[model samples]
Target: MPISPLRAEAPPMRVGLTPVFLDDQVSFLSRWRAWLEKKLERQVIFVQRGSYREIVELLLSGKLDFAWLCGYPYVRYRRQLKLVAVPLWRGRPLYRSYLIVPADDDQSRSLADLRGKVFAYSDPDSNSGYLYPQYLLTMQGENPSLFFARSFFTWAHRKVVEAVGVGLADGGAVDGYVWETLSETHPRLTAATRIIGRSGDLGYPPFVARADIPEAQLHLFRSALLEMATEPMGMELLESMRLDGFITGRPALYDEIARMAVRVGRL
Candidate 1:
């Protein structure tokens, strides 16, 4: 038998993923790292940031090769960042924001009913967790600071659900997809929460890279994601996360969110 040589590793790629949608961070980090490495053929160095603003800054500074960022932040920095891909969740690159209250609380049928109660917001830069809610307040001519007796940012969608479920807050704004997935994966935890309202379809979050990445590499990265749904292993990974596949995104898809942000003074 002839001797075989070993294959060399590809150059490492620096990546950052938001913990916004992840409830089981350890498992998600492991699976995502493995999937990204295999697909991109690069050793990924996963970076951590506490908020979307920080992640955007890291990418803008050229410290991160790419990042998974919320739609709100993506639109905020679209001028400096380029969209690599957007996850198609349930067959569409769209999602919604949800306002949830305790399941047993029948009195609160709508957001207005929950006025004067404490509210939980996930992240300041979050469309589902904060922006959409603020937009709703503005549309209703309600002031968040005064409409709700108090409001706090929980930093994560799961935490927002937890806060509302545990009675720490009267209600919360959360990612509708996260809440639905959590209901299936962690039923007991979310059984106490009932969605009081939901926002219209909004652009899904995206995998973004610096606008200055080499043209060839940028195209390759986008292709890898768009083809993930056809690969058996990639398909499996997407299924586990309740994602349909990846799709190319346009800046116009996020115009509504931007409009909402401007209405709420976030833009």
Candidate 2:
């Protein structure tokens, strides 16, 4: 009788994430992890943190194998990170920063109109949530620090919307994709706010691996993301996440974000 070969499983890979995407989708993460483990034939552990800074620190310290990071951080630390994939939103690797105000505030048309009002920023390290808005203020000859009556970081995009929705903030900066997605998942929260201004399209947040991670592991995860649109279960997940798919986006895709970072000079 021929002996059956043992199915070898690779060591677990740690993926870091902030609440920017997960929000209340706890079960979704479990299912997603199951899919990835099946694809890689290896254990996959997700490291969830409340803030991007925590995840970034873990990733840079070699504790995390991969992370889905905003364009701002990915560009700022490009040398230490390897771009693996960029999410597709609306069928393209692009999204925008939305400056939002309460639904009843029809008088405010742009960021300029919200001057000296309390503002909520998702995260200081966030592109759409902080850097782009800061750059816009700098370019317009205003100091971001002094432009608002007060400003605070919520550390998560969904929280930014929540802050503005309940009038805890007069205005807020948020990821366009997150806002639109919540419109479907949590319409009442979104209905309480309105997008008063939108930034020029920017690179969607990207999936990245630590530069020193094993090449085989990196390629496997990247391929899994890129191939997500091809299978039924993957497609369902994509739709649930409101993403079209993932692509091997170029570094130039984040040039605009890098420019914003440079202009803000806060990094």
Candidate 3:
């Protein structure tokens, strides 16, 4: 018989992530990494960043092959990134920004009501958490920086909810998907806050690859995500994520976000 040689393991695929949607999901991320490695036949490394700025910086510097990024940042850097896949929520790759306040506060009915109040922002690059709210004020001829008496970065959507829920902030903006997910996973906490306003549907944050990433690696990673709804283990993962599935998303899906960015002069 002819002798066979051992094959070497490929280098790890570095993926960037922030705590925008995933606040403290260590176990789920571990399982997800295993699934991706199995599908791609390559080791995977998940890089955690405290903010989207770190993720975007690493990705742009070629230290990261891919990252899940908010639509606002994605649109701002669209020319430098390639869309990998978009997660489906309630059967669509769309979500909204939620304006929330304490449940007992019935005086607040809209964004205008929250002016001059303390606010919590998930991240400056966050579409639903920061950009949308800024655009809201900008379109109305209001200066966002001056509209709020004070604002702070919670860095995570869940934390934003906690801030408003505990009266730490009079109001806050958050990703509607994260808010909805919390309503399911931690009902008591979500119950403490009430949604006072909702923004127009925007592109769901998307997994993206560096513009120069090899096509083979990009395809494999995208396949691993898009097929998650079909396999048994994948279904379990999807259920835990409270997502429907992933789809090959078009760049145009974020056009509205880009337009909003232009309006806010963030472009």
Candidate 4:
């Protein structure tokens, strides 16, 4: 009689997240990791990349099974990635780019008014923190170099707020969602900054996987995320992350970012 073949164990799933949130939010991350591991019923490997570019590269290269990625990179590599889910912020999967300046400043009423001033950008790959603002300038025939006397990237949305609020930079671009959350938790840091301009509703970043992920695993991950709000532990995680819930997102949500890239000639 022939012996039955032995079944091989599947490898653990790898998940990558961009460093968009506060660095000290370790408790939430710990809970998130535990919840995901339990819900997925497979060993879950967690990875965090400080830069969106690195995280996206890992996801696209198939080194990461899933990633929480920025909308800008998502649109840039839409062909290579697939949407898993989008976070619901204030009941909708939309956010805005905020142009900010020192609260005491009376010279600027809008983003264009801050032309020729020093500017702080959050990150090169940030949608609300950089790309949308760059696109705004481009719409008026301006780019960062031409519109601002000098510009620098703070590399994080919270740092962008601090740079502008403390007068290190005359103005800055940042994520509105992050700004609001900071206002509530770290009032001292945001008290001296005022929003000068804001964009219309833009797509928020999303949880994504490679276009080549196995169908069964993809469904399991997506379903788990979509149902996170209903679970006790998941609810705590969502609250800590300032998310209302998760939803199945459409690729069209990122079309504006793609158009912005084209307008700025970065596509």
Q: Which candidate achieves the best TM-score against the true structure?
A: 3
- lDDT of the candidates, in the order given: 0.84, 0.88, 0.91, 0.85
* Candidate 1 lDDT by residue in tens digits, 102-141: 8878899999998999999998989899999889988999
- Ranked candidates, highest lDDT first: 3, 2, 4, 1
Q: Give lDDT tens digits, candidate 3, residues 1-267.
A: 111232266777899987657647888988888888778777788888889999999999999999999988999999999999999999999999999999988899988999899999999999999999999999989999999999999989999999999999999999999999999999998999999989989999999999999999899899999999999999899889899999999999999999999999999
Quote the lDDT for 217 in model 3.
Answer: 88
Report per-prediction Cα RMSD to one decimal: 4.2, 4.3, 4.4, 5.4
Task: Enumerate clash totals for all models, in the order shown.
Answer: 0, 1, 0, 0
User: For candidate 2, lDDT tens digit of each residue in 71-162?
Assistant: 98899998999999998999999999999999988899889998999999999889999998899899999999999999999998998999
Q: Model 2 residue 150 lDDT?
A: 98
As a whole number from 0 to 100, the lDDT of residue 228 in candidate 3 is 96
**Runs in model 4 with CA error above 4 Å?**
1-8
Candidate 1 scores a C-alpha RMSD against the true structure in Å of: 4.2
What does candidate 4 score on TM?
A: 0.93
In model 1, the worst 10-residue window by lDDT is 1-10
Which residue pairs does candidate 2 place in steric collision?
A: 116-149
